[model samples]
Each structure stands twice: as C-alpha cells, then as structure tokens.
Target chain A: MTQPPVIEVNGLMRSYGGGRTLLGREKPVIHAINDVSFQIAEGETLGLVGESGSGKSTTGRAVLHLERPDAGSVRFRGTELSTLGQQGLKPYRKHMQMIFQDPYSALNPRMKVGRFVGEPLVVHGVDSGSSLQDRVAELFKLVGLDPSFMSRYPHEFSGGQRQRINIARAIALQPGFIVADEPITALDVSIQAQIVNLFQDLQDQLGLAYLFIAHDLSMVRYLCQWVAVMLRGRIVEMAPTEQIFADPRHPYTRSLLAAIPVPDPDRVRPDRPPFDVAANVPPREAPLIEVAPDHFVLDHQVQ
Target chain B: MALLEIKNLTVEFDTPGGVVHAVNDLNYSVEAGETLGVVGESGSGKSVHILALLGLLPCPPGRIVSGEAWFDGRNLMALSDRDLRSIRGGEIGMVFQDPMSSLNPVLTVGRQLKEVLTRHTNLTGRALKARMVELLDIVGIPHPEARLSQYPHEFSGGMRQRVMIAIGMACNPRLLIADEATTALDVTVQAQILDLVRQLKHDFGTTVIWITHDMGVVAELADTIQVMYGGRIMERGPVRPVFHDPRSAYTWGLLNSLPDEGARTQRRLYQIPGSPPDMSNPPPGDPFAPRNPFATERCHREVPPLRDVGNMPGHKVAAWYDLPALLAAQSEKEQTP
Candidate 1:
C-alpha cells in the first residue's frame, strides 16, 4: 500500500520583473520556476538538485508559501495551503518549517540562541516558561549541542555550531516537514558529513519529511532516497536515487551528474560547454514521460 | 636544484588570549613548473604560510617568528619592503577567492589590466592596449575589446574571475598562487576554471600553488598533494600514491569522509569526531590525535617526524604507524563490504 504524501506541489509557477520598467516599458520576465510538480511522502526526503538560477530555492520557498508563487497548488496533509489566509495558514505552519543555507544570516545575532529557538514555540503558543526552557535544552541535545550554549550569542559559535543551533530552531516546534535549502553547502567537508549524519539521524528519530535542496550531487546521493533534477525552472527528471544514479535518461541530468568533480584523479571530466543558456535550451518542450515504475524523465527532443 | 625551498618556517599571532602558532617549523620544496596542491581545513596554516611567504600578512599582530624562504637564490623573508614590492606582482602573481572584490568595481576592466602591466612592464600607449586585449583573449574572455570598457559589475561571476586570471597572467610571473580561487563558483564553472589553469600552467610554464579544502579539486589540478593540519604538513606525495596508500590517519579520514562517487547506500559517512585543534594551545604531539580513530599512545605523547615511505620515492608522511600495518588495516576496513 502506498502511503499518502505529507506535502504535494503541483503546476508551480513563479516569474520575476515583468510588469513595467521606470520608463513604463515592458520588462523582461525571468521564469524562476515553471510548471514544477513533486510530492514528499511521509518521513521521506525529496532531493532537488540543480545549478544556480535553476529555481530550486524558489520551488522550496513556494511550497512553504513563503514566496507566494504566481500560479500553483500547495497541499499540506490534505489541506490546500495556497488558498489559505495568514490566520488560517497559522495552524499548518507549525508542522512545516524551513532551514536556510547560510546559518549566519538565517538566525538573529542580537538575540540569545535559546530565545531565538524558542521563538517558534512562543509564536505557535505551544509551550512557555519552564516547559519552553526544557524543550529548548532538549533540542540542543538532539542536535548534538550542549544545553548551556543556549544563553550564548550566535557569534560565539563556529559555523558548524551555528548550523546546529539553526537546526535546533527549525525542529523546535516539532516540525514534521522541513525544507532544508543547501543546509550543508557552506560547511567544510569534514563538518559537512557531521551535518548530513545529523539530518539522517533526525529524520529517523522524528519521522521528518524533508525537501533537501542542494547543488552537490554526491551529497544528494548520500542523503536522499529520491532525487529530482531541475533545470531552467523545471524538473527534468525524478526517480529513486539508485536508479537515477545508475541510469539517468535526461541529457541535462546526465550532463549535471558528469559535471560533478569526482575525487578520483583518473576520472575524465567531459569538456564543459560554456554557460550559454541559449545553447542548452531544449529545441522542443517535452512532456514528463514515465520511463519505468515511478521514474520520469523530460525527453527534450532537439532539432 | 629546487625552484623554491622553505625551512623552519614558523609564523605566530600575538592575541589577547596568547600567541597563536599558525605555522611551526615547516620544511618543504617545490620543483619548477609543478602544481603543488595544499588541502586543509580552516586554521590549518596552508593559506597563512603562503601569505607569510608573500609578505601579505600584517605585522603588528602577526610576525614570522623564524624561517627562511629560499627562492631564486634569495631569502624572501629578508627582502626589504621596496624589494618585495618589485617581486610581488612582477615575479609572483596571486588570484584570490572573490574576484569581484579583488578587481576594483569602479575601474574599467581595461584600466585594471593595464595597471598591472604598467607596474611590471615598459609597455605603454597602443602597445599596452594591445597586450591587454591579448591577455583577455588568452584567458578566454569573449569580445575582449568590448569587455575592457565595462566595469567589474557588468561581468558575471565566471567572467569576473576570468578577468582576474587575465591580470594574474599579465606579468607572466614564474609562480602563481590561487587561494580558494574556484571555491565560490559552481561545479561547471569550477571545472572550466580548473581546465583553464591546467592549460595555462602548460602554456605559461608557471609553477602553481593551489590551496583549497576540496580534495576532488586538488586531485584534478595538482600534480602533488600536501595534506596539512594544525600548522603542519601531515602528508605530501605524488597524487596517486598519496591517495591510494595514505600513511597518515588524517589523510585516511579526509578520503573516507568524501561521499563515494558511486551509488548511494545505507553506509554512514566516516566522520572525524572532533574539530581542528585550537592554535593558541596546540597539542604537544600529533595535532590530529584527538580525532584520529587509529591514534595510539605515541600519537598523543610524541610528534612523528616526516619520514620517507619505504621504497616510495618523493612520498613522505608524518605519522606514528608503519606503512604495511596501516595499509593492512585500511584494506581490512575496505573488505567489510
């Protein structure tokens, strides 16, 4: 029996700068995400892999309703979040959260870490007073940080420690689903492994569903069970991690995977085509076709 | 004869807490026209050592406690300010991580490129303009003539970095130091830059000092790899031997920490349990001992001398364990399936 998805996103579209210029001329429209669709099963991770300007972050934010998409449908646990007002969305917001790429900027530096983490609880009115303190301390321990560090400022902690605090804040209200956007990209490799492991451990313990957005292919492969390849504001391919890695059908997905700098010195990287968007643009827009059981690829037919 | 040799290089910073030993009694030599890749986490002194060699570090808080950097039959440490200034951009060029900030935002790209040429060469007027355009062309910039008139803000990240490379190659320096040059760029762009540098190294016959934390980048670019940690070189050898048969446990940890290039599995990544050591109060023995899984009694109490591996020329490792034993243990771990 297939379990229902905790988060469902369909036909998501977002564009930037199209209305008018200072001279009242029509401005150029940059499609950040176009007709994107995906689902995150309960306690599952859906990896979104793409290069910069590929609309991965926009998709994550759009699903959270943080950046209201121009057109889309976002359903959280059978409830349509797109049509809900702020007051109505408040109840569902407690279950969904977001963890940013840069922990330094994501958190408020002036406030104490405890206050920052417990802010979610205060906003949601989940707990207060001594019980709030206990939850904050428990969160610290869960993310492998000392409880006493809650009183310290964000500057006192290292990058990894700050990220742990960020994770503590993200999971403070017992969020069932999180959009971790490039959570480990800014970290060193050694520290990166620690964060990835922590994410896995948290997923297993809390039964959390994650929309893991990142540019690192190997990292995505290591952490995610299902992967989606995004390019030019659309998902070109989506499949189980093993199958996608074993045999990627889309040309864009193949290029992206091959572009990754493998640690092996013997690996011969293909000659990279220059960053010309016009050159790689699909000659004909292809519909998402099922190549195998639950596997889809955008078969862009080039003229 | 070695192109550059450094001996007993020790750098320290006097802070409110204490003196932070950044580089301690390091000895290494680089051959002419070879790319020396330095891999280390932050505070490892890889960047600091080069900065010190280049006389780029500020002196009130920072001081080169002791060391001799021998290059071109002269001690770079003893060079006067004026003398060093002549050598810096003329004899050695540097490419920093953030190219946008490195290149002046207000200045036109042409003027910036010409300034580097004027400082080191006698070319002026039309000759200088021609050389600037040629340098831009060599670095793979499109419409070199038009790009010259544009400011740094007009160019993209990759384009700005190319402009920086053009400036670095303007003087045709013998040694090029690139510190985290490609770290900020995306993988595809990084591959392009790596390829450009690799090709430039051959074409220009310039020795390179490539410093970064990514082992994959080092493997792709550098002919030799130097694994550094806690102000010391943990391992140094040709890329193949150092990767295939790493004697240092730290190197092993770094290699294992890298996600396997193949398919994803249920296996947990190898994590080095602790952070890097504090420079102010560094350990008495192996700096990596606290995090090393195979650390022994000697690793904690006594420092291991840099010794040549048995019958492996040019491969030196600083560790307490014997080569055969370490390889046996590594192979055994690999056999676990």
Candidate 2:
C-alpha cells in the first residue's frame, strides 16, 4: 500500500458484565474482546482467524464504534475515533462500512434490495434522486451483479448471489476502510471462491483496507498479508502470512493449522501427536508476549 | 457387493419459478465401511440427492425424474413410506450442516436419542438408559450421564456437533449421510468431527455419503470422491486422480481457489471467472462452460457425459479437453493473484 495506515487500534479492551446487571439481566460477561491491537495499512488486508468465541468479530465491530470499548483508542487515517460519541461518530461513518457474514439475516427482508443498499447513501445525504439509482446500479455492476436485478428482495436470490449484493452494498459508499465479518463463510463451496475473488478485485479497484474476520485458515493465508490469531478474547499469534505458516510456534496456532484439511490424499501429516493431555498451555491470562520478530503468542490456559 | 447403489438417479423440483433439474441421471455407489465424499458448490444438488434417497424431499416440489437408489438389493425408490421411514434414522441416519438448527432446542439431548432408539430397537428401561450413555461416550461428550439432561444451547458449537453425531449413531445406522456437517465448525472443531466420523466408520462398518464443499476435508475423509456440478455428477473416481490432477474445469477452478497450508504465494487466488450457470434457465451444454477459462465453442454446444478416462479401472472424468493441462493452466493463473 502506498498510503499510510488507514486504521490503527491500540490496547483495545472490552468485557460484558456477568455478575453485574447491564439491563437488570444476568449474562456471562463473555469477555467478548480484550486488550486487542492491530493496524490496517492503506488497502491492506488483515485477517483475524479463530474458532467460535475468539472475539475476532467483536474486535472488528468495536473498531467501527458499533460497540463501546471498555478501554482503548481507534484511529482512522489521522483522526481518533475513541473520543467520538454517537453525535461525533455520525459524520465519520461515511468513511467506514461493514459487510456482515450472513447476507440473508444481515439484510432487511421487508425492504427492497435497492432501498437497503441505498439506505446508507440516503442517510449520509450523499444522494437520493435519479443519481442514487445510478450509483446503486453502478455498485451492482461492480460486485458482478446484473444492474437490472436491483429491483429484487433478499429472499429472491440464492446464497452466492445474495452475497454479491451484500458486497455491492458494502462498497456503495466508496469508504476508505471496511470490516467484512466472515463475508463468504455462509456461501456454498463454489460460491466462496467467486466471493473471495470479488473481495480482491474490489480491494484493488477501490484501494479499500479491510479487517477480514473468518474461520477458514487457508483462505486467510491466501487473502491477507498479515494475520492475527484470536482465542478466548485475545490474539494468540500475529505475523506475516508466510512467517506464520512456515513455523507456527504457538500451540493454539498449531491446533488451528492442523484443523485445515489437507487436500492431497497422498500426503501424510502427523496432526494428532500424543499430547500429554494434561500439558500446560501458555497462560493468556496476561498480555501477549513477543516470540519472534513479528510473531506473538499469548499464554492461553488450557483445561 | 456394494452396500448402496444409485442407478441413473435423476431428480426435479417444482418450485414457484419452474421445475429445476436438480440431479441428472446420477449414478454412484458406496460399499460397507467406505466413505464416498460428494464434492460440489451450492446448487450442485448434493443435498437433493441425499434428500431423495432419504424420502425427505418436499412434496409436489421434489419428484424423482427417473432411476432408483438400491440398498442391499432392494430398490429404495420403490419402497412404501412406512418401510422408508423404518430405514431412515433407524437404519440410515442423517447429519446436516448447521448443528444449531439440527438439534431440537426445547427437548433435552437424551430425549432425542431415545426417540431414535425407541423407533429402531425394542430397548427400554435400563437398556435404553445404558445405551444412551454409551452412545454419548462414543461421540466424545464429557460426563455423558450429566449431559443427557442438558439442551442443545447448553453445549458449545463443537460439543453440539458431537451430540449430533451421537444422535446420528443412536440406532447404529448402517449408512450416515453427513451433509456439510462440519462446514459451520472451526478448523479445530472440524478436525475433531472428521476424526469422530472416521472412528464411526471403523467401529460400525457405517457407509457414509459425506457431502461437503471443502475439497481439503474431502481429500482427508473420502475413500472415493463424486464431484457434482449444476445438479449433475461431472466427475466420480478415486480421490487421488480427481484431486491430484482435476479433469473438469469447474473442479480445477475449485482446487485452484483453495487457501492451502503451503507458503503464501497464492497471487490472485484463481477465481472461476463467471457465476455458476443459472439453474433457472440452464443451457444445454456443459454447466461450467461459461465460467471455465479454457472453455471452447464445443463446450457450450454439447454436454459432456461422464467418460472413463483411459481404461484405468474406476477412474473417470467429464471434460472434452485435457484435464491435466487445464488444471495446470488454472494453477498457474492462481499464482498471478
């Protein structure tokens, strides 16, 4: 990326109230995301990978200010976002957008696809007349959808096509940075490749920096230049793509790498070693410790 | 002898739009204790084929266009609903993609297992309780005696999938149709589930129709792979040939697109250029012709039948061109991204 970092996150910390009542209700504080930090260079792709409850999705949402952080600061370009309240954040939202994982659930079923995609444009007072329709049509083409099909509902399209529409909506604003939360995870096997390629295309054409959150480790290695492996609300490892795959030192990272199915039938990978089942895992109770030049690991506690 | 044989099975669905030819004269088989992985993207009719065999398709919408699914020398397509019901869940269990929706939320996990057991066997009282605990243990659920009382939501994503396996194996079904069962799981959880399925096959001689989109996962689990496209089996053969050097252009595109564990030299991630052929108005030729980079005029004009590639026993491919060359080209194209 020729430009400077588009987004910088520092010492991010957030936890839900378990014992205390948020709305007079009891819930496991989830410890959703804690003390996470990362940066997205201009047009760079930073992937966050983990199993369920890893808090990757939470971290992405928090940076967009969709959720309040207990502690931390988020900076976009040269401006800081942590100081922005609802009123102050409204103007800056035009520069940022989010693409959710589930297209069907994320979209408003009751509304027309055009209205849903164009709603952001309208809210920002960007455009609303014939120009809005033109922009929407252009977006449809950009995302590999037929512009004539804009007069449709979310339910009308299949999983893959619906995802294309979701992509169109996310890129509608020409935002500087985007948070795509598992955008292609719900798609079909064949559809995943198309969606992934579309992301690459959009990134090149629009120069959009993205915080890509997903569970698919292989695609992450392909798509992102840098990656952060999250677990139980903290990043356990971070490094350049090649560095991480060549030698994953963290136990959690190794387990994640092992999870990816080897495509070659002739290949033999000794994935399941005799782990002393009771061996001590790194205690992630504290902050992440640097293990290598770029790689980092958290001492995560295991059962 | 093969445990299950699908002889030229074809299927059609009556949706509001029109009749969609879901499975076109598909023929395949599975032997006892063998796992046949069916690979395809969405709309490839992987689920529909399994649904037809299970007699679980929606009425008026789903009609077997022709052909039959034979198991143990009996034609399942000709069986009465009552007999089919006896086979389903009792003799052949199913596991779907999303574990969250597959299990009943209102009912405890034990109750669900008991339903299948009561349906298949005559076990009751102590025997039923004992069998339930044993099944739970086999699926690797911790503290089975205590978890029997817990509901689906109480378990994590991975644990819930284990419960699904326990339920699938409840009646000790001869065949298990795992339809995208682990697609929703994390890599670690996915590995655990795959290992469990493998163990199930080893212990029970359970033949499996493992439907998934992940090529990597299929390569790991399947003894043989059946690659489907546009509601048809474009390629069916041993996993090695189909995967090592794919014949079909669609299969090539899929393989090239995967994010592998190898060093990150994947440039553009070879993406299939066009969307899957519109099934609503599907054309006459190869369904993947439009999206295939190496597609020629002949590809758009004639639907290539699944042809035996050489006389190499069970190996087969369905392309009009050299598959290995096409795959190599696609692989090189992927490196450019």
Among the numbered candidates, top DockQ falls to 2
Per-residue lDDT for A185-301 in model 2, tens only? 887766787888889999999999989998888788888988898877778788888888887867777777876787889878556532222253334357666777867666553
Provide the lowest-lDDT 10-residue window in model 2 chain A. A273-282
lDDT score, candidate 1, position A146: 90
For this target, which candidate reaches the highest TM-score against the unseen true structure? 1
lDDT of 1 by residue, B77-108 (tens): 99998888888878888898999889998899
Q: For model 2 chain B, give the 10-residue run with minimal summed lDDT.
A: B269-278
Q: What is the DockQ of each candidate?
A: 0.64, 0.65
The interface root-mean-square deviations, each candidate in sequence, come to 1.3, 1.8
**Residue pairs with backbone overlap in model 2:** A282-A299, A282-A300, A283-A299, A284-A299, A284-A300, B267-B337, B268-B337
When summed lDDT is taken over every stretch of 10 residues in candidate 1 chain A, the lowest stretch is: A275-284
Q: With candidate 2 superimposed using the best TM-score fit, by how many Å does residue A150's alpha carbon deviate from the native? A: 4.6
CAPRI class of candidate 1: medium
Error of 1 at A116 (Å): 2.8
The candidate 1 chain B region of ten consecutive residues with least summed lDDT is B263-272
